[model samples]
Target chain A: MPASASSIPDTVLVSADALHALAVRVLLRLGLSQAHAEAMARTIVAGQRDDCQSHGVYRLLTCAQTVRSGKVELQAEPVVAPTRGAVVRVDARRGFSPLAFERGLPALVEAARTQGLAALAIHQCFHFSALWPEIEALTAHGLAALALTPSHAWVAPAGGHRPVFGTNPIAFGWPRPGPYPFVFDFATSAIARGDLELHRRAGTPLPAGCGVDAQGRPSTDPLAVAQGAMLAFGGHKGSALAAMVELMAGALIGDWTSQESLEFDAGAQAAPCHGELVLAFDPARLAGGDPAAGQQSAERLFQAITDQGARLPSQRRYAARERSLQRGIAVPRALYEEIEALGG
Target chain B: MPASASSIPDTVLVSADALHALAVRVLLRLGLSQAHAEAMARTIVAGQRDDCQSHGVYRLLTCAQTVRSGKVELQAEPVVAPTRGAVVRVDARRGFSPLAFERGLPALVEAARTQGLAALAIHQCFHFSALWPEIEALTAHGLAALALTPSHAWVAPAGGHRPVFGTNPIAFGWPRPGPYPFVFDFATSAIARGDLELHRRAGTPLPAGCGVDAQGRPSTDPLAVAQGAMLAFGGHKGSALAAMVELMAGALIGDWTSQESLEFDAGAQAAPCHGELVLAFDPARLAGGDPAAGQQSAERLFQAITDQGARLPSQRRYAARERSLQRGIAVPRALYEEIEALGG
Candidate 1:
């Protein structure tokens, strides 16, 4: 193990490097190839570095279980098709999505850089991360990016009584000449599935607008809504957007919809095997003028937002990232121990 | 001036062709060239044909006033830039967007067909129509499309009190092997600006989530919110989307942001002169497989939605379109007379 900070009974502070190396070791022991282990570890460490604990090291439990059950293609290599204009296709070969995205980002970035716009379609993969990481990666290349994917059938369309859509998420990133780019990743559903699970684990009532009971009636019980259907945010409009995600990421790519993905999950222990769509736009190409002027123009809008007392969407996450960089991430002692013991 | 169904005290029926011609005549009388008048008329006819009263002939009232103020470049022609890779641009020359969109569609369709994906950015335009017409037009060509544009500054961001964003609208279309495509066009705001005006005229209270007063307190008064701030739909998520529109359509295209557009409006009578962004994706190029097979796969998801007894968005509009085809459109006599008297 690498260096770590002093620990307490309930919380353990670990350096980002140590946390990443530990995650890689655990994944390697659990059956992932070294290449995939490194890729997955980078993603998990990013979640913790940003203080998004739900997607942090806590995910190793599912990874271990899913692999043990022979659900994941532990050694499968992702394949990228030769670029066809502005659309790039990546076949994940029934493995996880992170490695595939990593392999294909170069092609996507190249296409967008030259063509002004490009879309990447990743198929036959179990997507395990929020889209922000992919969006951020594109933003790092000074590209504006939009990403979407459908998960297991856990959310109901607005006005429907059963789950037909996933906790489909849409994420966007706009490049800026600042410390961090403007980014937002959110599920079209009223609440994210991970958040719902945390609420249920704590035996807490859900906030209003979160969900409907099994009978399609409003309910505060996290367990009930978890077993029932998650409502789309903003009612019908959000539902329409969720459906758009299903079509764009799923049908448009000739992959499984959320319903089909859930059916494939069978026992439901594994993450949903699905598809993702990512579109990146280069401001310089689109502006048809000076890219610097475009960036300056965009800054005015951001300044206007902050000046009026409204916080930008990812300010909290960015602040947490700053803090985590200074002091290591603190994790629950019990959860940390569990992750440490995953290889046992 | 033209043949009409015998007028009743409250309503008069007009054939779609007749209605289109009337709209053309009215716009022509207001100084629009014949080509521009015809372009604008088709959009107005489509709205009434779909039973969307808010966007129908009533829009002529605003069009007349706007043109009379010399705010519209009535004879200005749209110029479509030769395709630059997968991006196409149309300079509206300060005219209404309808004629510009008409002139640009062919180039956009060709680019999307050859490149798998394409984006059409229309700049320096006064957009005065709902986006569905543009979306549906693309769907008619067997393509999936999405369009968005910003309007006058009238909406508040989710956490902010003052209005900074527009009633930005997003529209999407998916092609299917059926009479009507899967389509949805909606404002990011809780309620559309036209609907608010209707509520105020009828002296009805605004919907619960519609708006806030000048002090940022929630209010049901249409007039107060109109003078104050209209809320974004779905809270923070919708607000973020609205902001995205501002960047993609405004700054990304090097056009006016909503705030700048409002400042240009000065006394607030002209339609927002900004930019529009439309993205078209070719199912065939992106699928890299059998196009018909992909369409078949998409139909399964649509079937699942209807199987759950949940109505898909735009079903009512399609139904109304069918009715209008058979029985013609019924326009309230008073409003019809108002439109007629404008030409006189």
Candidate 2:
């Protein structure tokens, strides 16, 4: 493989399949089981294909370090409890979450189909992947889905100085008639931890209100925020949402809170071990009128969004996906070389 | 009831029972049926008792006008479809939503108890009350609840200049071992439409980003924003949430979108008649571990929030409630006179 210097500079153009194969080999070499490797690879590839670089191959570095830190059970088998009474439980046994989600998704889809709504709870997993993938999974089954999960405690409550809450992302997906679903995944925090880390690595100043220093004064220094705390987006409202995620995905699910997850990390900065809550709704079953009418109604909302030049939540991602499929993804050549070397 | 002049000035001290009686009488005088009057009265009194002024007796003025406009079914009875497969459906018959919700709460509670999680879809109602009462209803049952509803299209989507979404509110309540359930109900818009109207009436300027002018330029003029569009909180994330509410509470329930609701009003500006979605989760049924452990976990999160000097959402409201219970609510003398005149 060679860098595509013909058009783009310092970028390697690689097919999705080739990237998946490389990711799988890398995961396998790093000690993941076959199922785990494939699930993880698929998620990473999807991130790349969708141009969500934060969740793409950049994640491999942290994952590899996490495995080396003796924190993750790379080959652990996930156990799924049979779906009943609108709840689907999957015990990830302290392993990576992707494999557990894959095992539990079918039962979730079936339950939602039968009951009009269903919940999927995955326990004790390294929940490092973006929630959009999980949400998109349900959307693909023609279901509306909501996904929530806690992360390490690096964000402060709206009016507080200390970090007690996680980035705590909430994701939602609505099924539509076309290839793309109306999708959005956003952190309750002012900014995602990954983006903060990116700024830290590049020695860049954060946007105002992104974080506070150790003394609780607002600061743009990513390093200071890394040492102190990130602020919740939209102030108090976003903070309330973060608390909701913590309570629903953490306490309600009988799992660790962000504070607990951080303590478990012991300063390793590894993937946060926690649980996830995914709720799916079958529109055809849930809607009282004709399902087609509901779908048409959804289409009108989307069209209205575009008509006003307001982009849908995942519009850019879908556009990037199309471009990637046609012209292959553009990965920084240096990063590509580094990822390739990780397989050895 | 005579005005209590011992401590507070320019106020009339009225007991909850007395206030309820007055509100009920006023609602009935406005042509509401007994059941509708009682339900609306209870909600209005609850707001006053909680010190939530926006939802208190101030709402009676609007309720009276709406009834006069023939927009509400003063004597209509809500129909409840029995719980089936985690779904509890209610038809509000174009009446007030409070009564419909009251009718469906029991079925939703039963369904959640049986299925671990359940959804209540209330269709075609004049949803003029605050959502906190509906949320508290579920939390009182030891269930975690999430409620969403769309109002008139007075807000713009993020990045767009046109009004297309509503001041859609998302309310959540989590049960705890305390006097108050952890509760938060906030509009997806930068500020509630009621607050904007208040600012306009008071000749006060709005905070930056609260809304835009008729030309879509950022403006602090509440009247201009009223003529144009209100902005969503936290920018795009809040906008995305507002869209979700429109789809779920509107399209998914086969009811009316904010745009549709606005069009239906035909510039009447009456209460936006639409649907609502309330999802409940029975903690014991949903938890993978001992139910007590889950409860304790929730308690810990609450404690942590307070320990960090951060006040939980609705803390002030709860405190106000305790004060109101001990020493009757203090109503402004002029408003008390106004309400009494309306009842006559």
Error of 1 at B24 (Å): 0.5
Tens-digit lDDT track of model 1 for B181-300: 999999999999988988999999998989999999999999999888999999999999999988888888778788888888898488889989999999988887777767876898
C-alpha lDDT score of every prediction, in listed order: 0.88, 0.90
lDDT accuracy of residue B91 in candidate 2: 95
> If you score just chain A, what TM-score does every candidate get?
0.96, 0.98
Error of 1 at B329 (Å): 1.5
lDDT of 1 by residue, A132-178 (tens): 88999999999999999999888888778789999999999999886
Cα deviation at B16, candidate 1, in Å, is 1.1
Off by more than 4 A, model 2: A2-5
Q: Which stretches of candidate 1 lie over 4 Å from their true place?
A: A1-9, B1-9
